[model samples]
Target: MTRRRHPSLWIAMALATSSLSGCRCSEPPAEKEEPAKASPTIQRGDAVLVEPNAGDFFEARVLGLEPAAGIQSLKLQRSDGEITTADAVDVYKLPDESAAAAASKQPGLAPGRLVICEVAHQRWVGCRIKTVSEDGYQIEDFGGEEHRISLKKLMLPSELTRMNLEQRFKIGDRRRAFEREAARAGQPAPPPGFSPGFKERVIAKRGDEWFSAHIVRFHDDGAFRVRWMADDRENDVAKVEVIPEPPYQQPPKRGGFVLLKPNVQSLPWARWRVVSVRPELVLQNAAGEQSQSSRREVVPLDPDVAASDEESP
Candidate 1:
């Protein structure tokens, strides 16, 4: 009879077969498992994976929902230690409901907290958040000048971001109006007899030639004056004088034009005469008697006139 086979061998054979069967059943499936459906979540000061491969992810804080864009833009801290922005479509909510609720109720930037001032003219400009009045915001510019801006002219930054050419023009017009008003308020008023619009004509004499200049002034007497710019400088610089016309020989009878004394210093060589005398030319003479001689002819006292008078003598 054959020797009885060892029990251990049979047991070993069964164990081997069982191990092979398990290996066949445990082989990995060919298809990949889809990532869990991402849920919107507020970011806590924690690092999380943002991408599918787990290779690229950013550390960010969940600021708020941007419903319009339909994307969550997180305030992120970059690897370089700088705060930047990152966005994701699928965001997940935190497991802690109370924490999320607290974040939602926290106060953030006020609706009208920030403003931008674009300078239309002049240097230095800034913006401020002021209480809204019926008129509009009371803003202080970079020059520390305070201005009341109309609501129509003021715009939110978000709104300004979308401004077109026409919108910018409107804003510019409003700024100009504010500047003009400020300038007017800060300037002193003109004196009773003085007018800001008064102008004067200057007559200068050189040899036999005459020249005229139109100067802008605050008074009819040419005080507080500015030099007139000549269109033709060479021709305008010739010698000239004021001369009185015929009607000025008689004293002025009623309220009418008066001749203003010309400044002799302005025209060294020119002799002044009251030219084109009006009804107001009547004035007391040196003898204390009213005389029409108040008006006289103004002429240049050139070398020729002096020589001729001497020769006549």
Candidate 2:
């Protein structure tokens, strides 16, 4: 070190020191990765759990995964005993094997078949598959009278042979037509020949006295036209006049009288004596009371003569 060193010897010593430092600074071994877990697959007869929002989980049988639109649909049994189908997003696969076995043992409708049920007094009757829908078959009671029901109200069918095609087709067509006509009318269905209540009144006048008469013609404006026989008239001819009330009104009272006056000039004779007062007409004698030869002699009371007499009086 005290003596002067060669240039090549100094360079070689520097190189050896750099190589030793590089060998000792290698990277640590990568950490071993844990194996990933696989999601369980859902199968038939599995006890599927549905989590609708944050509520308690509901247990139902796994009918099948029905592919529709962009996702799958899962048919489930409701706690209240009603069978329904819901989206897969609302359901989860259950891990309970015993629950799945119990659910599988329960009888279910065949595919394309549904339980057609007739409910009476809160009891189900006539339950069987009568028709098929795109996803399920219709179940109904073949022993009972046929009825119309919506498709969504039925449970999924497990088989198809139990379906009654004729009855289903007929009922569906009729129901659809009825619905179409009801929608087109836009008004509520009306009972046949519906009628409304109304009021009527009738009033008849004879000379100065007014008589209530029965109404024959009724109008919407609270007016009625009447037809009735004159109480005083002996003739059976019916007298008709438009009155205020119609359809129903009081009849004329008994003992009411009507008078018929003749024009003085139109009379056959000038002076007359009252004879008989029958219902037909007022009979009179055109004669003077002087003598037998003056029977036909009487005084004339024409319009002009009556007017002169009025002036003189």
Candidate 3:
């Protein structure tokens, strides 16, 4: 059965339907899904700076990654054979050698580049460029000491390592050459107070006294390469600082008197008769007790001095 509807009611229903459709058309479009955030990646064997502790980063190689509890830590090894662990947040990638080299080539742009500097003689240390000058680059060390370094003394870490290894090989070769020269008939001894040359066993002056030493080689700069018998340390001894080992003298007769100093540091040289001269110098005092001393410690008495002492007594 058809029921009759009022005209106002029909018009109101149509108007409500039209309004709902318009609202749907004006709705904002669904937002596009954002791409998942990317995580930064670091691989094994990469050179990196790691801070095992807060605020203390050092150069190291990434050994591996350790993941635990949804967090990652880095296994890093330092140049000195020390292995340490650091959080991923504290690990930083270093510029590759190529990049570092390229940056170093532009000295004008080297204000913050990492570098190796030979700050003192044979002392290589890590540093950073602070500024550039017409003469050379000004560098600041890890300890905060600023230095004006010559270009020749500054290098990238990789370059310094290679150069250092080569230098060591060269020094080793020179040392071998020195050994060969020493093995051959030793060089002729020079006169006292004269400079020493290669392969000469000498009494080199250290402080005011002369000590037994030998010149085994020559420095690149022509300085005498002296090896002191006292400490076995090598030095670039200068001319006029070295002389031949003093010639040994014939021992006096058993009853003959000679001056001797039992203590090289003590005063008052005492008279003693010779007992033996081989192996070591043996002397006897008035009590007939024997004491041993080096042949070099025995000295001939000065007649004038002895006479003056006698006259004073």
Candidate 4:
């Protein structure tokens, strides 16, 4: 039946319906959250720093990965050609570019300077600086291989000389101690040339290369401990690896002119003519004064200098 509904009641019902619909439309839809990105995994042939049992991290190349005892391990090869294994957790990948802004600056270090650098196997060898980098220095070794070395691994010639002198002094002290022990024991003096510090220079052969070096120790087993001049590195060498180097290679020739310190009391060297070389170097000055001297006491005069000396009254 079409019963007349109250106007107020109809309006209230309509408003109630509108309010419910507006409330439903007011809320925005819930959004879906994205997952966090994961880091790139380590792969083969990547340069990484690995820590071994020594607890020190060094540069190495990843050879491959292996599972040991249910834990992942990486096989790495060091710059020294040594292959080792470390847990994946101990390996860190190296960045393409160094994070440091600039390399540490040091005195006596510059591009093109010759230095001794520690490359493979912690062995120091001669290298030339190519450039500076935050990691260290870019250097080319004598073998033409390029490597980045830290500052502590680099040594200047002067610094190496200083170190060599210090090492020599230490060796000399040891020699003195040995001598004192021999004296106390009523033993005869150690054989000459068999003692340390016996020679100032020696030709030392190391790895197919002959180097000028100083004797650090002469062992009872006939082995020699020599310090190389090229890098001031000490190495134990066999007896055949070392030999005394004469003070002078070529002695003054007969009839040649030389600057000679005639005697131990002589303070300054004087120009003289070489009379004889064999037996001993006999010299005669411009005044016909004759004297005997060792090759080390004389400096050979250049041809031009000798000619000028002759031309002079």
Task: Please give each candidate's TM-score.
Answer: 0.16, 0.19, 0.28, 0.22
Q: Evaluate model 3: give its lDDT.
A: 0.51
Residue-wise lDDT of candidate 1 within 1-313, one digit each (tens)?
1122111211222122433453332444343211111122233353322221111123234433232353334454544466655443322222234443443333332323433332232121234445556534676543335666543322223222213222333444455554443333221112223222323444333344233444443433444333432333322221113221111223322322223233343433222222233653443311223434343322222212211111110
For lDDT, the strongest prediction is 4
What lDDT does candidate 2 reach at residue 116? 24
- lDDT string for model 3 (251-310, tens) is 344544555543532233455667776777788764446898764554433221111111
Candidate 2: list runs displaced more than 4 Å: 1-39, 97-313
Q: How many clashes does each candidate structure show, in the order listed? A: 20, 24, 0, 0
Error of 3 at 259 (Å): 54
Ten-residue stretch with the least lDDT total in model 4:
304-313
lDDT, ranked from best to worst: 4, 3, 2, 1
Candidate 3, backbone clash total: 0
RMSD of each: 30.8, 38.8, 27.2, 28.8
Local distance difference test, each candidate: 0.32, 0.34, 0.51, 0.52
Q: How far out, in Å, is residue 190 in model 1?
A: 13
Candidate 2 lDDT, 1-313, residue by residue in tens = 0121111211222122333453422454343210110113355565555534222235577665554664456666665677878655444444344433443344444433334232332233324455544543345453334444433232221122113333444455555554443234221111223122222222344333334334554556533444433332221112232222211112111221111222342222112332332332222321212111111122221111111111110
